[model samples]
Target: MKQTTMNRTQRTVCTVLAAAALAAGLSACAPLIVGGAVVGGVMAVDRRTAGTQIEDEGIELRAANRIRETFGDRVHVNVTSYNRQALLTGEVPNAQERQAVEQLVSQVENVRSVVNDLTITTFSSTLSQRSNDTFITGKVRASLVDAQDISANSFKVVTERNVVYLMGRVSQREANRATEIARGVSGVSKVVRVFEIVSEEELRRIAPQPAPVTTDDTKPSGG
Candidate 1:
């Protein structure tokens, strides 16, 4: 009984750790729990192709680094990339700074387009406000996951202040459903759809198919 209890405790600890890791966006560990695919599992479910997903991540990181080097705390910005299109949110001290930031982001490699949503404001958001925004993003994501008709993995949720920005490659139905779900979430002031709209036929063509399960029937009979 003691051994069984110890095993149960160890399993619970590992489960908690895995959940924390996933919440922190360390999705490479997904294969351990969801079968063997590494990051490929996530890519498979995402609306974007694996190459596009990788490129988007690279685009966001490079753009962010450039913004930091160029502005150096003169502006507050959050960069989100989906399907190689960049969305710039948060605040800037002035209009000139906002324009400059948009141009700077546009120059980042492989960024197909830029959506400048930077507010020209005198003050940046406080840490508490930013924390609240993060909480709102998580809540929106959870709500989407709970939604029956939507494939939550298809949408990327980013929150700034009280606004929720959604990015995805989805059909009109999927996009509308996702937007409605996001808007209905508590504390979400607005929903901005930055989706790469695809037709249902195109979405079906690009969607990843489930891997086939195989069974080994050649095992020798045991005595």
Candidate 2:
């Protein structure tokens, strides 16, 4: 009875920890504690290292908080970070506001570069338009996943007002393929590639190597 109770307690603790990790966006722990299929699917499919993924999340959150505090609702901006590079999308009231947002994002820790895709316009997008952009982004991601040649995990897709922004560390061929796939998605007005291009050889080097196979010799020879 004591053993059974101990086992049940352990299981409950593990369940709680896994839930906490998922809620906190601790991708590294999610795969191990929870089933990989449930909480860590994105982390597993992502090409970025676990550390880089966490850093990217941090950069986005920090930049977003700063922007909101500075501009309130006067400017609408969406920030995405991949491999320490930031992409700023959406509408700003003027060129000065656009440049200011970019400068602020660049100052964020761990943000190595910034792609200022902010359009200088009079007003921000409506809720319905933002919803459409979300749908478009989901479609692009699904298309990339379905493409045989492209690794969906290698690309991060973002959409604002029908414009799709693709960010990743990928080879030229992969980048082109992803762009074509995103462009083909319905309702995507434009496809912008913010890729850090790497050569085939470099990709090979960075890719995880397969473990060596070992054969068991204990089986008796056939008669």
Estimated TM-score for each candidate: 0.83, 0.76
Candidate 2 C-alpha error for residue 157, in Å: 0.4
> Compared with the true structure, what per-residue lDDT tens digits does model 2 show for residues 36-148?
12344343245567788789989999999999999999899999999999999989999899999999999999999999999889878999998898778767766765566
Q: Please name the candidate that would achieve the greatest TM-score relative to the true structure.
A: 1
Error of 1 at 71 (Å): 0.9
Candidate 2, pairs of clashing residues: none
Stretches of candidate 2 exceeding 4 Å from the true structure: 1-45, 210-223
Report every candidate's CA lDDT: 0.81, 0.79
Candidate 1 to truth, TM: 0.83
Give the least accurate 10-residue stretch of model 2, judged by summed lDDT: 32-41
